[model samples]
Target: MPERQAFRERIRLEAAERFAAGAADAEVAKDLRVSVRSVRRRRRAWHDAGTEGLRSAGPTSRPKLSEALFTVLEQELAKAPVPHEHDAVGDRADAARARFQSPGPGPPGDRARRGGRGGLGD
Candidate 1:
């Protein structure tokens, strides 16, 4: 993955350099074995934010949980084997489900049916 990213960055850098040297998009695309549209996009990004703009954006997702909560959850998950590891999968799954059930309010799907905010109900 790192090698692929490095190759992509190298391509962007070379494309930017060629475009700055007044190379046509079609020519740069052919030389780099990439599409002319990609070359043009890279050129626009370079013009807008220099080399930094050509760098990978990395992952777009942010964690759904807070860092502290995520850390606790990770630790908890690490302590237990997955349900499928048991000889009796169905029983193990049921036991695991019961162990993690929400103790708040009414029975399982009741709140969901009542138009409550979250959960698999919706």
Candidate 2:
């Protein structure tokens, strides 16, 4: 979990004190720049648990994965060799560009073939 803002911590403390001093939740909320709902919640927590309830809960610890690892993996994959029958990188890229530039499939005027769909035959 992330830490709460310093302003929020201060607001919670001041709001709790104002509540204990007989200020209405709405008035405390307005003065503290927080919602009335938050004021009421803080009031209840202060009444039940005192100032400890108003202290920041602090942040939780959790490990995060590194993004550089992903970029390294992608670069490794892109540099891997293709089969002998396939074109080299430049030729393969040109072939892909030509295929993409061709008309696409649809109805009679579509760029797609309508018969004998031949993928890996599976």
Candidate 3:
């Protein structure tokens, strides 16, 4: 887990102090402008352990895409996608067109060819 911001860490520490002084969860939550659930959770941790339980565990995540790979992905996305040898690509394109194209003033034969209703209630 990434560490909470410094202010947030200070807030929890302050809550620990209030917990030590025997302040109620609602009172702490209202004073801190934090959720009552959060206050209750922190209170439980404070009761079980000291303020150390409220400390952040530092960052545990890494970027899914690195900087160099990200640039290549950005360039690829900037260009238009073209279908090549894959037969399914054409089917996908046709499905996308059907999904996006609103019914317009076209011929009944055209609608039938596109696998749609020729008119209302068809």
Candidate 4:
């Protein structure tokens, strides 16, 4: 991913340089192996923010749910029935109803129930 980002940044820099040299968007797109739309977008960014705009913005960080909220969600999910219990039914309606019923305990090999991190298990 980092390598891909670096390559993308290089392309953006090259596009910006070509644009600064008064190259057409189509030419820059073809030369950089990118879409003309990308070239136009890079040109707009360059015009709006100079060389800094040509640099990668880096990955965006998303906020995770708070532990309290996560716990609530886990509790809600825990109320759902186990998938294995419905497997033998062979009936679609029964299977659907079973899927919505509480599953009770975790299945074998469930890391969360085995005291591993990140699940409804305490």
lDDT (0 to 1) per candidate: 0.87, 0.75, 0.86, 0.83
Q: Kindly list the per-residue Cα lDDT of model 1 for residues 2-32, writing each as its tens digit.
A: 6887899899998888978999999999999
Best of the two (1, 4) by TM-score = 4
Could you tell me which residue pairs clash in candidate 3? Answer: none
Clashes of 4: 0
Estimated TM-score per prediction?
0.47, 0.46, 0.48, 0.49
* Model 4, span 23-107: residue lDDT tens: 9999888888989998888899999998898898887764398779999999989897757654455678787898899977566
lDDT value, candidate 3, whole model: 0.86
RMSD of each: 15.0, 12.2, 8.9, 18.9
lDDT of 1 at 64: 85
Q: What's the CA error at residue 62 for candidate 3, in Å? A: 2.9
Error in Å for residue 83 of model 1: 28
Q: Where does model 2 exceed 4 Å of error?
A: 1-4, 60-122
Candidate 2 lDDT: 0.75
lDDT of 3 by residue, 5-120 (tens): 67788899999999999999999999999999999999999889888998766545777999999999999999998877757889899899999998877764787687867667
